[model samples]
Target: MFTGIVEELGEVVGVTPTAQDSVLVAVRGPLVTSDARHGDSIAVNGVCLTVVDVDGGVFTADVMGETLRRSALGTLRAGDPVNLERAAALGSRLGGHLVQGHVDGVGEVLAREPAPRWETVRFRLPVALSRYVVEKGSITIDGVSLTVAEVGDDWFSVGLIPTTLALTTLGTRAVGDPVNLEMDVLAKYVERLLGARPADAPVPGPVAS
Candidate 1:
């Protein structure tokens, strides 16, 4: 699991395709690779990728077909910046919310409204995923945890501080750019529990005391 806290802004160095409908992605992250080794998991742009090889400050991971289909990672090319975070260690501070590094859906940046202290960026929320978003709720974008500043039927906004704008991939993202999104898992669990049965459905029999 991850904490949705970006530790470094890494750059994609290369992408190589394999015969098994998978691509090898090599990312350069000095900080993340300082003590890295094989068989490690790294969150790259909100998608968890296992380390296949680690050489110097660069590490390579294979992106399978399913991940490519569900995330914006497929569109990444060499020189693209990605938010990088190592898996959370036991008992460590949960700086951000629980993140599975699983991209639920992709969203597009609609607009960016700059302010004196921060910027409120609006994103086009997918119809299916819009219901999971709520104002003041936590949302993961490109592996960076952010709070929902506003929400609409088909869109949501998040305020970005200067630190976020300077350290993550969202800083350079332009209008219409696709981003990986993961909503709060707790909300989904609540929805599932609430929708488990119809209002008129009969409850199961209880044991005799």
Candidate 2:
């Protein structure tokens, strides 16, 4: 689990393709890798990845085909900046809602409305994930937690303060750029609990008269 708080902005040092459509990505993140060891999980651009190797302030992780297909991480190349976050500790403050570091789907930047101290950015939400978003609700974009300022059937907007604009990759995201998006996990859970039973679920029998 992660808190959706970006601890560092790391750079992609290399990307090497492996067999079966998987790839090995090497990232340089001094802060996150300071105490990282093999098998440790790190959230990079909102996708959870396990460390495969650590060398010279850089760590390598294997990006499976599934993750690549589901996230914007597939577009990453050398020198691209990525948000990095270490796993949440047991007693740490829950600065953000519980994040599984799972990229539910990919969203594209639609527009940016700049202001004196803040900016409102709109994103094209995937149809399948739109129902999970609500006004003023929390959402994680590219690993940074933010509140939904405005929501439409297929789009949502977020107001980014200067701190967010300066600290994370979102600051530089241009229109049409793809971003990994994770809806509030709690909302999904609630929807599941209240939704109709699964196809394989046994139907309730009629009460005996």
Q: Over the full model, what C-alpha lDDT does candidate 1 score relative to the true structure? A: 0.94
Across 1-209, the per-residue lDDT of candidate 2 in tens digits comes to 99999999999999999977899999999999999999999999999999999998999999999999999999999999999999999999999888999999999999999999999999998999999999989999999999999999999999999999999999999999999999999999988865767878876789999
**Judged by lDDT against the true structure, how good is candidate 2?**
0.95
For residue 115, give model 2's deviation from the true position in Å.
Answer: 0.5
Candidate 1 residues 1-209, lDDT tens each?
A: 99999999999999999857789999999999998889999999999999999998999999999999999999989999999999999999999999999899999999999999999999997899999999999999999999999999999999999999999999889999999999999999989987998889886688899
- CA RMSD per model (angstroms): 2.6, 4.2
Candidate 2: how many backbone clashes? 0
Error of 1 at 205 (Å): 16
Give the lDDT of residue 92 in candidate 1: 99
Q: Residue 66, candidate 1: how far off, in angstroms?
A: 0.7
**Per-candidate TM vs. native?**
0.94, 0.93
Clashing pairs in 1: none
